[model samples]
Target: MKIYKYKDSVYCDEDLSCEYDNYAGDLYDLYLDLKEDNKCGETTRYYVCDKYTGYDEPEELIEEEFSDLVIGEYESED
Candidate 1:
């Protein structure tokens, strides 16, 4: 399946962290904890990379299911 890959320097940790893969989904507010804590945060810029994996579980996949905003690839991380 397609997923967002972290490609930011530092600010990614501020807003993008904690947002789940399904965070792009809608079930979050329906059942997850911190129901009242729902609010759109600042729109921080982020970089993106496309990666495909067949594994049911990926390595870089967050252990706690977090999100981190990123900056797009201006200069290659390479």
Candidate 2:
């Protein structure tokens, strides 16, 4: 399946190192959700990568769900 990854600085200043992969959904939908939160401040920023990743969930898996948003190559946590 295809999925997207994104990053956001929510409910805090970008310089605070609070940015993380904290949201999941369509870009616009996520943006609106953040906007409604109001804690992210007016300058909160959202970023969507340019390539989509192929994701496969193990049939017996129970951890991590799927997200649909902008496309991007998956980055290693390392």
Model number with the top lDDT: 2
Model 1, 8-74: lDDT tens digits are: 2222222333544333322222112222333221113211123232222322232223333222322
Whole-structure CA lDDT of model 1 = 0.26
C-alpha RMSD of each candidate structure in angstroms:
14.6, 13.7
Point out where model 1 deviates above 4 Å: 1-59, 62-68, 74-78
What TM-score should be assigned to candidate 1? 0.15
Residue-wise C-alpha lDDT for candidate 2, range 1-78, written one tens digit per residue: 222343442222112123345534433343445346541222222222232222232210111222333343334345
Alpha carbon lDDT of each predicted model: 0.26, 0.30
TM-score of each: 0.15, 0.22
What lDDT score goes with residue 19 in model 2?
A: 32
* Winning model by TM-score: 2
Candidate 2 TM-score to native: 0.22
Worst 10 residues of 2 by lDDT: 57-66
Q: Count the backbone clashes (under 3 Å) in each candidate.
A: 14, 4
